[model samples]
Target chain A: MLKDKKNYKLIVVEDNIGDFILFEEYLNEKIENPTLFHFERFKDLNDFQDKITPDFDIIFLDLSLPDKNGLDLIIEVQKISKQIPIIVLTGYSDESFATTSLALGISDYLLKDDLNSTTLYKSIIYNIERNKNLVKIRESEQLYSDLFQLSPLPICVYDIETLLFIDVNEAAVNLYGHSHSEFLNLKVDDIFHDEEIDKTEEIASKIMTHKKKNGEIIFVDSRSNTITFNGKKAKIILSNDITKSLNHIREIELQNQKLKEIAWKQSHIVRVPLSQILGLTQLILDDKETTQETKELIIILNNSAKELDKIIQEIITKSKEISLNE
Target chain B: MKHLFIIDDDAVSVLILKKMLSNADFLETPMVFYNGNEALNFFSKNYTSVDTYCVFLDINMPVMNGWEFLDNIQTTIHPNNFMVYLLTSSTSEYEKSKSNDYHCIKKFISKPISKEILNEIKEVFNSI
Candidate 1:
């Protein structure tokens, strides 16, 4: 299928002329970038640095460009501009290198073997669509900030380096008794409760942490992710207020302990009669005994069996009493 | 001479427990009580005569149960520090916790109390 006819201004940053021609042949596009730069060596990349433009919609990168190998070149490219969607082009042998490249903010990777006219077009379409979604997600977060002014579960995302709140959902404002601007003024640890964190999990890994807000400690469980928030590197965190549920579970656990204590008695003393029945049944079934011995065994089994029936009745009665009180 | 008491309503159980203690050399003479009430009655009558160090008790019984026996133990002439080993087929959680109530009770052995359980009893005896 033809691309959803994107007049997308694409910049091709590959060093190999053969691969570049193949990329064009693969895209089957008659048109080419007016500012397409070619470089087989690292010096060529430095020479053409300022020649890059802001209007470029897609960046096709080659990891093994002679100036640098692996992420060195990708970092150099990002040092230039990160807003444009990146599509990595790598030969099959260096295919594994694409994942690291992608993690470093490359948008997509195209296997040289899988590079067909259709695939190349599809990659471009998908990468552009993904970029569109990211922009929309950010826009939605911004446009709906006020509507979240009093959300019950307050959420704040901040930059790792700046320790500055990038944004707080509305629930955070009401929970902290702070306005959005007030939340923005506080660091995560300022209102975090030590007891709450200890009661919960120690949320202190750079991956997680506890902070105090309004004389109360809040737990922050965060995932280290790469995102361009406010045109700078930042973190996105989803936080939950667990204070109420924490105490609620503690009471339930105590009740469960009491039930388990009784359940313990049921397991030990209660099953004694049943197990005796089973073991005695085994003894009677063993044919290596005399008829007289078997006769005595049957008598013992009958008495234990009758005793167990009575014990079950007593247990049922006591259990009903416990249940009724419960 | 160390004399231990065995309380079990079943004759076979009493026999098995008797053989186990005898083989393990638990004491010079160990008395048998067919039921908890019999043992309690024996204890009531004995009062201060015999030096009884241990009592092997069964939980389920007619007339009076093991728990009732333990309850009566608090009121009896049976002195403290006499550990009770619960020889029972009970794997009940309640029975295990109840074992804690009788400070005199050392351990609960699940049945059929085999030679392995006999070994465990020996180990407890050796430790004490």
Candidate 2:
């Protein structure tokens, strides 16, 4: 009842006037006040293509036109229809051809012998709904494709069985110093250093040593997951270069080792002589036979020795705090 | 009677300890050994449990070190008869902590032994 109240805009392209009139009657039985455009030949539709807008919901194309028909007519109509759904009207003899036409982007195919108000109306309603869903799926797929192409971190997809590269993004091409075509020819193990190539099977979220085309060895934090790519079982790897930071950590560790060695020397080797100086000076200052002038100089000497001892103590304490991390 | 012993390689440090002991009026004349080996030899020959012994032990020496001396003496000597004071010039917390492992070691003293330190030693000796 609700479908009978809706106005449907339809385009009918047929060489025979009788078939066009039958399609119009079937459409009118379901849709009230339907706007129908009739084109006698494929050229007539081509000529009126500029006036065709997206608001025209469906196009009923006859497979056997006078000048153009079959796949050529379907393609030309689709080029003009754009988002509009097209249903092919064919004979019983062209039934197999009409079914194959669906693979070439035809929305639905109906035999002219099976022509009835109910079947014709059902094809129009079903295809228009299916076309809208197809458009949504295509847009979302394009969005994901754009995300893969424009990513900053180096990403690559490789076939899991052959271990060969299937696809690589722009960042991966630049990082590996390989052209896009060169990367496709290489296996995933080709980028790894010889010692690390054997461990490639377990490369999920691990730091591995890799070699570039220029023979520069680098460290990469690689994270990978299994994904089906282009109908093949594949793995997608995201690589983060961490060579500079790891080298910086090693340099700091070496400096801390030197500092620890200095601390040990200050506590043991340097403190021994200073202890003797302090002891001998204290003995002089305590002697009853020593002159006042000599005792005064000995007191001054003792103070200087104590000050040097304090400085050495502070050095040892500060160096002991030098840990590997900080 | 109480006996005093000084075991150190440094001559100046030993002289200062001996002077400080006399200045503190510690009655017994303290015996001296150049290293832990000399001290161990003396103890093996003349050790008597009848008299209480006080030892001033230095850590670093040529033939035998302070830790080796303590390890060797533990089996031969009774801890009650001997009170050992460890003296070292090195300011290492590791050595100080390690000294706690020896039961006969009475005190850990940092070097350039002062008059007040000797007096503290005399007080602990007399009380014991």
Candidates 1 onward: DockQ, in order? 0.22, 0.50
Misplaced by over 4 Å in model 1 are: A1-6, A29-35, A41-54, A142-326, B1-128
The whole-model C-alpha lDDT of candidate 1 against the native structure comes to: 0.67
| iRMSD (1 decimal) for each model | 5.3, 1.3
What lDDT is reached at residue A155 by model 1?
A: 58
Q: Can you tell me which runs of candidate 2 are displaced by over 4 Å?
A: A1-152, A170-185, A190-204, A211-217, A317-326, B1-12, B18-53, B60-65, B68-73, B122-128
Tens-digit per-residue lDDT, A32-100, candidate 2: 888888999888999998999888889988999999988888877888886688888899999999999
Tens digit per residue, CA lDDT, model 1, B20-118: 566666654677887788888877776563454677888888899898988896676444446688978665555678788777777887776666667
Could you tell me how far off, in angstroms, the CA of residue A231 lies in candidate 1 after the best superposition? Answer: 25
